[model samples]
Target: DCEFLGIVGRNGSGKSTLLKLLSKIYTPTKGDIEIDGSLVPFIELGVGFNPELTGRENVYLNGAMLGFSNQEMDAMYDDIVKFAELPEFMDQKLKNYSSGMQVRLAFSIAIRARGDILILDEVLAVGDAAFQKKCNDYFASLHGKQTVILVTHSMENVMAYCDRAILIEKGKIIEEGEPAKITEAYLKLFNLNS
Candidate 1:
């Protein structure tokens, strides 16, 4: 049941659209899409964050949206802050936080939230290198333990984390196979298109 799948393609090639469909943020206009488990989507980080609210407050607010009760959020609150490396900034208003700070907090919540599947869109591109390494290590650990659907342009990421991958072009499946082959084909698309 655990599978790490990557969707790779050029910009505007429906990679994000596919994630939306999977997360039910967009219903497919055509075929039936079925998902067997609950999904926690990190499609647009900081989407629901409020500028006026303190980070601590927003954490609780966002946790509620994910269907976590106060007790549950309380249990996870420390880990979330710890992971985001924002322990000192939690009481500060979100508007005062830098863009990097905001994204780290959002990413932390997405990873820590309980769900059967994780839907991510360019999430690894965020933060500084150290944080990115943390993220990479986290995904590596989840390799055979979690079902993750990642939409990314980083061929390195596809090669490193994906068990399987699909290359999308112009809103269609161009290829589906091993991560290495799909990434190689994805790179070739640039030469062919140009």
Candidate 2:
């Protein structure tokens, strides 16, 4: 049941849209999507976070949206803050946080929460280099152990982590195969479309 699948495409190619459909954040207009497992989607990280609220408040808020009870959120609060590396800033307003900080905080919460299938949409593109490495390592560790749907522009991620890959163009899957072939085809799109 565990499959590490990668989706790659240029901007506006429906990569994020595909993730949304899979996560049920968006309903498909013409097709049926049958997901066999529960999934935690990290789409547009920090989408539910309020700029006016403190990071701590946002954590609870975000957690609640993800179906966590207050007690559940309380139990995981410390670990989430620690993982975000923003223990000191938890009490501060989210608006004060940098984009990187916001993303890290969102990512931390998502990682700490429970889910069988993890759907990530460009979540690897943010945070500092070290944090990126941490995420990379986390994804690597998930290989063959968790069902992960990764939608990234990073070909490096596809090559390193994906067992199979698909290339989407104009809201449709144009190619599907091994990571190397999909990546190569994806790169060629730019030259051809340019």
Candidate 3:
């Protein structure tokens, strides 16, 4: 959201909350968070999803949250499972699904719903190595076309995906710059690399 928007910091640095605030999932205590366009927050897809509901049902529900209608979701149904690679279990209740499956479905839905601003948490890590690579590839394909904010503890991944990183400490920004330098500072400041 700034000149250098990647965020890195120690535990409890309000990084998640910051994304929550920007996505309107959490209200700031003092100031109103402002963004000029449509915003979508990619949270854990299983958090509020009904486990008893089939993957098909969950797709529409998650789509609604992302501002898509049933017809829209229907159009994207095949794409979602293809991206998630769980086409075989599309009719099963999500409760019968594994955590990875749930995450896959959730992420698939999130990825399909277009937005002007996209905020991604660490939820993508729930997938296996192969799926993570797929997600990364999809993210790269969207590079510079849509405004994307990625939140993660993996400095290497952040460095690879983002051009700039911002360091936050205890709810306030402490530093901001190119991904390499800012991540280095964050690791040293937090003793993360040691």
TM-score of every candidate relative to the true structure: 0.96, 0.92, 0.90
Give the per-residue lDDT of model 1 (tens digit) for 61-137.
88888889999999999999999999999999999999999999998887767899999899988899999999989
**How does each model score on lDDT?**
0.91, 0.90, 0.80
If both were scored by TM-score, which would come out higher, candidate 2 or candidate 3? 2
Which one wins on lDDT? 1
| Candidate 3, number of clashes | 1
10 residues in a row with least lDDT, candidate 1: 106-115
Pitting candidate 1 against candidate 2, the one with the higher TM-score is 1
Superposed by TM-score, candidate 3 places the C-alpha of residue 128 at a distance from the truth, in angstroms, of 0.9
Task: Kindly report which residue stretches of model 3 are placed more than 4 angstroms away from their true locations once superposed.
Answer: 1-4, 192-194
Which of the two, 1 or 3, has more lDDT?
A: 1
* Candidate numbers, best TM-score first, in rank order: 1, 2, 3
Question: How well does model 3 score by local distance difference test?
Answer: 0.80
Deviation (Å) of 104 in candidate 1: 0.8
Error of 1 at 59 (Å): 1.0
